[model samples]
Target: MTTTNLSGLVAATYTPLNDEGDLNLRAIPSMVDHLLAQGIEGLYVCGSTGEGMSLTSDERRAVAEAYVQATAKRIPVIVQVGHNSVREASQLAKHAQAIGADVISATCPSYFKVSDVATLVQTMGEVASGAPELPFYYYHIPSLTGSAIDMGEFLLQAGDRIPNLVGLKYTDTKLFDFQHCLELQDGRFDVVWGCDEMLLGALATGARAGIGSTYNIAAPLYRRIIDAFATSNVEEARRWQSKSIELIRTIGKFPFHPAMKAILEMRGLKVGGCRLPQGRLSKADAASLRNELEVIGFDVEQAGGLAPAE
Candidate 1:
């Protein structure tokens, strides 16, 4: 099916939870407001950043609905429904469509590991079929999925098999492969860049949009990069991209997602810590992170236009 391509920054949002690790659905509205205020163009809910795999079917559905409702059609909300079980992922895709998600995306089953391109196509096709009416994007994050089939080949084959297949959230750092996907069939697929740090490289290779977690905490910085790139200010773009790498590296020192949630909390959103396996940031670590970010010139208010949480 034909669909409008996604452009600009789409935040792979964090799923808010309470102190007990239960879904804190109440926090989604303010999170959406905060991202929009920071100039995010779309919301990608239940993706890796949102701990989609860590959550159960019921919880994923709840999180998707909350984000979709809070966004209120002001921006597109692409729900990521990838699961180990293709059936479950498809069910989530159907639910996403039923709940009014703008698009549906899924990763190949990670546990069993998709063995080849054709198998990968069949797997994703099942998931995309669930939301037949909406555009479908294959979440091609091979690092996590361990299914490093040639994406260029996969697209060539899946294009006809998966009718709703629009493009990919190309996450790997292979610029050549990414460019191949972009130029495939006269750029038929709307391949969105997934690596936040390599966005400038992707742009040079013709990326029109990016879906990333850092955008939640630092959209303004990235927007400057986009603006500089668009204006052909190569030096300015590099400067901004370097700052983004610095910010990401600083957050990387701690538990990444937890540190991100802490930044959001510092900025006034009640986005609690991540679930187990990616646990919460300790108060001491949070304070230390604050100092580190300050040294890097990352003021939450200035960086994201958010007021400090009371």
Candidate 2:
């Protein structure tokens, strides 16, 4: 979203569920500590990567509150309270603010299939109006929403009407569209590349932050990559980015949530397992992932290791 908190690396957290498919509020404090210890710049909770689409309204809000309390002001937590309903989004945003979240973001309403520019703008405006004081970002992933909003008008209107319109967690695969977003909103919005594949290209064009599912496993490496690049260590950054992408490709091979959880368990975090619908990673898949992880310098022991770059 807009404001000083929007810039830098914000990991879209994976919602950790308990065995009964309930929200795992207790696991958050250690998770937040893990991320903070790795130098993660920010966090986006209850978003797509966090399994927001699958959680009930109360479960999602509870997770948001847990995250806010767990983070304990160590870093910014951007709560994603988007839903298919406007009232739901408004209520969740209010919840996010009440829980002390640094920012609140929402995606365009999905399943309606209304692709017209007018309709898209109206939907975002309604959500923004609901949380008038909070900094908001358009969760622009055409892949999930089943409908696409025009960034040109959205960005333009966001600039004018929504004073707290901070940025977009861009998920549209096309760099041209992403670039157009940066160009149109140039100085006005801070773009956070939601997709892992586009991080380098996004960084090239001045994307201020990255909000990705993969960052849960690779935050330290990302921290290294971003720091290297910012300090003009272009070559080192290239090395880190290449390694990062290689690791991402491995995680991408499986359903992302379980794969991430598997990695955590392998590391001995005792983070527990993914609930059904998302399900557990198959045994074969886990082994293959284990191998892939080892290749990228991640080992069973290294998973929860404190070596920093080990």
Candidate 3:
């Protein structure tokens, strides 16, 4: 596997949909353009933000293809192929490699929790082997996967077992575990931070990159956090991070993903609301969300560095 690791803000992108909740593949190009304009360094398609688990296998592949094609190599597209089935996840991985995706990531099967590090490693190995040509990142999201196995142990054992295994997309709030994984094997793994609000803490713990949902709406703000931190301006970095927390909290007041899609719609992207269970934001809720965001001084136009639409 290539030794290159993801750096900067990688957006765990949204799966654009129509009002009917069908894949609006046509919207992907503009969505990608918006992200690039926002200074997103990479794209993580079909992750939690993208509602990957909620989609069918075919739908997932189509979404992955649309993102890869839209990106057109301007930046790396990391496809998250995690599924409830290991075999299906592997098939998706193979498809991702076939379509020339830069990297592949997968969460362990969640319906039946992976019992230990060995099972987790084996499960991931089977998935990663499907795309042996690409680097593999095991998505460590304990809250969603219900498998809170120690990542340090998993990585240590997986290093030799899975030849293509590279790093993790750590989404938990555990700073010490994250730090240990980052420093393990003398930083052998590319541990991209996944908690948006805790990014400042991750940076303090030596995170070089972050992948998250909030980055889709506010990459410029997070970029400022990174820049300030790199320049040793801790106070400024904390200020930006606090703003991020405010934004996230405001959105969290409603159905988080649907509210995020609504924010994107306000910004002029036709990204419809999320799929079932997560559901859509009501008209009233959307209006209230807009008001809340305004009260917080969130400039939808300037949120991602986009110029106001004339």
Candidate 4:
């Protein structure tokens, strides 16, 4: 099998919107610069961080297209096409393919739920069929989808059926299943880790690529963690990873996406706040979060300088 390796930091990017909650397509250029400046390898757009489920299909397509065009093929852009409806997911997948996204990923249908691994395979198979030529990854984020089908079992059965099945965006805490999926078929698939706080642990267990929300602001720190590990500086890696945990713990105090967008704004990105259902941080709260992040050693200016050498 010819495997694809999407290693290093693949940021699950936030969809930039204006204060009015409309798509801010112009922000894509700067967003791309911010990510590239940190030496981030690629982007996972319209995923959980991008609030894929919250937007309309047309909105998702516009967001995906902006990212793709802004990137101009500089790096891989994996567009999350998952929806509660398989047909909708397939349509998004086909749209992603048409827009030149590097890969397409989908989570399980949460409302109806996949009754079993076979059903999940069928569900995902339909979505993947839309973009038959593109690599497909199952976004196994059971926390949000609430469909905790064993990934190992899913892969075992689905691997043969989905011709474009490449791997999974392993987001659940099931390290055992993650390892099983990683080692399965002699590492045939790319199992990109998702949980930011447990990233070091996942790296220890053979996770090469990682996708997360925090990567949008903290890519340089995580890149250092990866670099430290590469040089066998385990202690140094642990220190950097610890900072990541602290950052998440602090930001998670508010609504996660809103808090994150606040941080980006504080850093001068102006990516705007989260839409309703995700409330915005007040001026006081935003100020406090900024102080907390600064105390944690996040230097907005220096982040770009910390990117790994090419």
TM for every model, in the order presented, reads: 0.97, 0.91, 0.97, 0.95
- 1 or 2, greater by TM-score: 1
> What residue runs in model 1 are displaced by over 4 Å at the alpha carbon?
303-310
Q: How far off is residue 65 in model 3, in Å?
A: 0.6
lDDT of 4: 0.86
> Model 3's lDDT to the true fold?
0.92
Q: Report the lDDT of model 1 for residue 262.
A: 94
Angstrom error at residue 178, model 4 = 0.8
Q: Against the true structure, candidate 1 has what lDDT?
A: 0.92
TM-score (C-alpha) between model 2 and the true structure: 0.91
Q: What's the CA error at residue 59 for candidate 2, in Å?
A: 0.3
Q: After superposition, how far is residue 191 of candidate 2 from its true place, in Å?
A: 1.4
**Which residue runs of candidate 4 sit more than 4 Å off their true CA positions?**
1-3, 300-310
lDDT of candidates 1 onward, in order: 0.92, 0.76, 0.92, 0.86
- For candidate 4, list the clashing residue pairs, or say none: none
In candidate 3, position 309 carries an lDDT of 19
lDDT of 2: 0.76
lDDT of 2 by residue, 1-310 (tens): 3357466667788777676667777888877777776567788998877888888899898889998988887788988878899888888888887878888889878877658776766777777776677788888888878876678677886577666787788886777777777777446676678777657667776777888866666676777777887898778777777776777777888987888888877755555566567787878998998887777676555522212332
lDDT of 3 by residue, 1-310 (tens): 6658899999999999999999999999999998999899999999999999989999999999999999999999999999988999999999999998999999999999998988998899999999999999999999998999999999999999999999999999999999999999898999999999999999999999999998888898898889999999898888888888888898999989999999999889998989999989999999999899878878775555322211
lDDT of 1 by residue, 1-310 (tens): 4489999999999999998999999999989988898899999999999999999899999999999999999999999999999999999999999999999999999999998998999999999999999999999998999989999999999999998999999999999999999999999999999999999999999999999999998898889889999999988888888888888999999999999999999987888899889999999999999999888777865545322211
- C-alpha root-mean-square deviation, candidate 4: 2.8
Regions of model 3 farther than 4 Å from truth? 305-310
Better of 1 and 2 by lDDT: 1
